[model samples]
Target: MSEHHTLYAAFAERIDAVLSALELEGALPPGTSRANVSVEPPRDPSHGDLATNAAMVLAKPAATNPRSLAEKIVEHLSRDPLIESAQIAGPGFINLRLARSTWTDELAAIAALGGDYGKSAMGEGRRVNIEYVSANPTGPMHMGHCRGAVVGDALASLLEFAGHAVTREYYVNDAGGQVDTLARSVHLRYREALGEDVGAIPDGFYPGAYLVPVGEAAAQEFGDRYRSAPEAEWLPVFRAFAVERMMAIIRADLQLLGIAHDVFSSEAALQAAGKPEAAEAWLRAHDLVYDGVLEAPKGKEPPDDWEATELPLFRSTRFGDDQDRPIRKSDGKWTYFGADLAYHMQKAESADELIDIWGADHAGTVKRIKAAVAALSEGQGEPIPFDVKLVQMVQLLRNGEPAKMSKRSGNFVTIADMVDEVGKDVVRFSMLTRKPEAQMDFDFAKVVEESKDNPVFYVQYAHARIRSILRKGADENFAPSAEHLGLLGEDDLALVKRAAQFPREVEMAARTREPHRIAFYLADLAAELHAFWNLGNADQQKRFIVAQDANLSGARLFLAAQIGQVIRNGLALLGVEAVEEL
Candidate 1:
C-alpha cells in the first residue's frame, strides 16, 4: 500500500539484493555496475512468470561462466518463499515462477490502488515541456497534424503519470508569410460578405470556405472601413483578426479529439520581445555565430545561379551538422531557423527537458535545431536535455480508396470531420495503434468495424464484458469479496498476472517515450481477458456467476473487477475512454 508499489518493482528489488549479497561475498567484483541487468516477462510465457538476465549480464564481471553464475543466483533465489521455482534457461537466463499467492496479492493491490494502479515515480517530479501540433495559424487542423498531436498529448499524460511536472505546449507560427496569404484570403471573403463580387480566390491565397465566418465577423466589426482601402492600410488589421479566428478553429478541432494544450506560445510575441536579438548576441559572444557564406547546393549538379551572400550563420557544423546554418535572410528578416533557435532557448530557461513532436517532413531540419540548443544551453553553463520526435503522415482512406477532401477546409480532411464520421475514441485509439514514426493508414471502414480485428473495439469490449458480468452478479444479490480469493485457480491467477503487468508496462512506455507501446500492451491484455472469458463458454462451472457457489463466484467477480480496473487505468493514460457499454 506504499506509494509506487508494484509487483515487478518488488521482484526487481529482490534481485538487486541477491546481487549485492554476492558482491559482499566476493562472488562478483565490488563496485560493478548492474545497470545492464533487466528483469522482464519472458518472450514465451510457458518459461516462467518473470525472467532476468542477471547472471548472463554479470558473468564476465564476476570472472565466471554464465552457467556458474546462473546456478549461484538461482540457489539464492530459490530460498525466497515467494518464488515457487527458479530455473536456468538457455544461455544462462534465469526464470522465476512466483507462488500463486503472489498474483493474488497483486490483484489485491490493484483493487486497493484503483485508478492509481499503474502510476510510477520514475520521473521524480522533473519539469518536462512538450511542444506539439504547432500547425500554422493560417488554417484549420487537418489529418496531416493529427498523428503528432495525439502522440504528443498521450506522451505528456504518460509522463505525468510517471511523476513528471509536464507542460503541454503549442507554438503559434503567426509571424510568417503564410499568415499574410491567410489575411488576403480573408479579405476576399470579407468583400464577398459586403456584397462585392469577389471573383475566384487567387491561386496564392487560402481557398477554404472556412474563412467565410471570419470574413463575416470582420465585415460586421469594421462596417466597410477597410473594404476599399489599399493593401497596406488593411493588411495588418485583417492579418491579426484572421490569425485569431484561425486559432479558435484549430482549438475547437483539437477539442473534438479530446486534446487541450496548457500553453500556446506565439512566434510573433517571441520576436516582439526581442528574444532573437538576445540569442544572437549571446551566440556571437561565444563565437558560435559568425558572418559567413554557405556553400552551393550538395547535389551532383549544383544550381548555376547559386550565389554566396554574407549572413549571420550558426556554427552548426561544430556540433555534427553538415554545414553552418543561416539565422537571418539577406533582407535582415529572421529565417524560420533563427526564430526556432530563440524559441528553444526560451523553453530551456524553464524546463529540465524539452520535447518537440513534429511531422516527418521536418526531419531534415532537426540536426540544425539540435545543434543550436546544444550550443546555446551549454554556453549558459547548464545543458538541457532535448528530443525531437518525427511522426509520419497518416493517409486517410475510404473503402480502400483515398478519402475525399473537406469542403470546409478546401485542401485536406479536417480533424473535426474525421472525428465526426468515426467518434473521438476511435480516432485517438487508431492513431496510437501504430508507432509514431511508422507510416499508417486511417481506413475509415476498418477503424469503425465492430469486429475483434479492430483493436479499439476489442479492448473496449473487454472492459464492457467485465462490467456486464459485475452488473449481473449485483442483480443476483452477489458482491465481489477478497476474503475467498484463495479459491481462485491457475486460469484465474494467469489473468491476474497479466493484469499485474500494467505498472511495468507503464514505466517501460514512459522510459522509451513511446505511448504506442501502451496501446500494444492493452491489446495483449484484452486478448488475455477474452481468452479467460471464453473459458466460461466451454464449461458451465468456469462461468463468473455460479448459481449455488457464492464464495467461488465472489472471488471470480473480485478478479474480474480488478481486471477491468487495469484496463481503465491503461486507457486513461492513452486518453481513450473505457466505456461501460459499447
Candidate 2:
C-alpha cells in the first residue's frame, strides 16, 4: 500500500510477497522470517539485472537447503509480469533479468522527476544534528577546516534529500583559554595602533597580523581607556570584541566555500545559562562521577604539574573509556571535557541522532565523549545515536612542491586564498575525492587540469556534452520524453541499466552517511557517458542525433537528457554546479 516509487523497493516488495505466500502455503516451514532478504543489483551485471541472497540467508532458519529454497523462490518470481527470466546461481542466489520495458519506463520516470529523480523518504523526517568546523574564534579559517566543512555540508544535504530534518551546527569555543590569549594579542596590537612601541610578538601570544585590524578598531573605539588598565579589567572587554570580529572573518571565509551553519552554539552562553553545573548535578545523582585521584599517566608522559591530588572525575571506565576522566582541574575550574559533556547534553534535547566531524588530531577525545553521552542519555526517551568522524589532513602541493604560504591568513593557508586560486566548485569536489580518514595530497596544478584525472572536470564535461546535443535539436520545447523510447537498442539499454542504479546509489550513500560515495558514483556515471558517446565514432548509426531518423534520435537524446539530469542532482548534493558548456 506504500507509494514508494523506487524500482528496487518495488521489486523488494514483490520478493517479500512471494516469500510470505510460500510461508503461508506450508511448503518450507512456519515462522520463517524474511527480515534479512535483500533484492539488489548483482555483483556482475552479465549474469542478471538483479540478484537476491534470500534463499541462502534463510535456508538455515527455514530448516532446508539453499538450492531447494532458491528453486521455490524462482518459481514464484518467474510468474511476475516485469521479469524476463529467473535463474539460480552459485550457493542458492536467485538472479533475475527484468523486461526491457521496465528499463524504458524508468527512463520515462527520470524525465518526469528531473532533478528530484533519486530522492528517498527512507529517513521518515527524523531529526539529526551534524556538528562540523568548530574552529576556535581566534583567527580566520584555514585549510585545516576545509575538509570537515565540505564533508559535513554534503552529508547534511544528502540526509535532507533522504527525508531527514537535519540541523547543520557549529560550536563556538569562545569560553576557552585560547580566546584569552587572542585577547592579549589584540591588546598588544592595540598599543601598537595607538603609536606605542610594541616590539616583536612575545612568546605565548598570537603572532598573526590578522588581529591588527581588530586592535585598530578597538583603539579607535575606546581611545586609550583600556590600554593602560590591568589584565582583569580589559580581559573581558577584549575577549568579547576580538571573538566577535574573528567569527565574522571566519563566516566570510566559510561563505567562500559555499558553507553556512544553521546553528552556532556558544560555549560561553551555555556557561552563562548554568547548563554545565546542572549537567554535572544530574551525573552526580546517577553516581556517574566521583572524587578520585589518578596514578601516573599510562602510555604518555604526564604534564609538569601532574600530581595525585584528589579531584572530581567521571567514571568513564564503566562506559568503555580506558580511565576515569577528570571533570575539574586542580584550580577548581571546569575542564574542557566538562564543558563538552554539558554541550552534548544540550544537543540531546533537540536531536534524535548526533554526528560530529573532527580533525584527525582529536582521535583521543572520541572515547570519553561517547561515554559521557551514553551516561547522560540513560533515562532519556530512546538513547540518541552518536557518531564521530575523524577527517585526515590535506597536504597542499603546487606542481609537486610545497604550496606557498598565504598572506591573507598571516600564519596558515586560508580558505579564502584557496577559493581565490581555484573556484569554489573545484575546492569542494577535490576535498571529497578521498575518504575522510585517509590523508590526501591536493595538487593545485592537477586539480584544475582538463584531463580525466580531474573528476570534477570529467563529470562536468559529460553534462556539457549532453546539453550541446539537446540544444542542436533546434526546438524550443526540446526535452526528453517517453515517446518513441522503444527505439533503443542493446547498447542504449546498457546505458539505461546504469541509469537505473541512481536511486539505489542515493539511498545507500544517505544510509551510510558517506557523501564521498556520491562523488565516486558521479565519476563512474561520467565514464559510462563518455563510453556511450564514443560508440558513435565507429558507427554513424550509433549517433544520438540521426538526421535521417528523427524518431530514433529522439529516443537516444531522451536517454542522454536523463543522464544529464542525474549528474546535475548529484552535483547539487555536493554543493557544486553542473555547467551547460565546457
Candidate 2 per-residue lDDT over residues 1-582, each given as its tens digit? 122367888899999888888889776577777778898989888999999999999998778899998999999999999999999998899999999899999998888788788888888889999999999998899999999999999999999988899999999999989999999999999999999999888999998879888999999988999879999999999999998999999999999998999999999999999998988898998899888897777758887877788988999988778889988888887899999999999999999999999999999999999989977876576677899999999999999899988886667898988999989999999998899999999999999999998998999999999999899864634455568988899889988888888878889999999999999999999998899889999888898887787788888889998999989999999999999998
| TM-score list, all predictions | 0.97, 0.96
Tens digits of lDDT, candidate 1, 1-582: 246566877998999999999989889998899999988899998999999999998999899999999998999999999999999999999999999889888888888889999899989999999999999998889999999999999999999999899999999999999989999999899999999999888789888889999999999988999999999999999989999999999999999989999999999999999999999999999999999888878898768887888999999988888889999998999999999999999999989999999999999999989989988889777788899999999999998999999989888999999999998989999999999989999999999888999999999999999999999999999899999999998888889988888898888899999999999999999999998889999987888988899999999999999999999999998899999987
Indicate the TM-score of model 2. Answer: 0.96
Candidate 2: segments with Cα more than 4 A from true spot: 1-4, 298-305, 475-479
Task: Give candidate 1 regions above 4 Å deviation.
Answer: 298-305
Q: How accurate is candidate 1 locally (lDDT)?
A: 0.93
Candidate 2 clashing pairs, residues 3+ apart or interchain? none
- Alpha carbon RMSD to native, model 1: 1.6
- Residue 174 lDDT in model 1? 94
User: What's the count of clashing pairs in each model shown?
Assistant: 0, 0
Which numbered prediction scores highest in lDDT against the true structure?
1
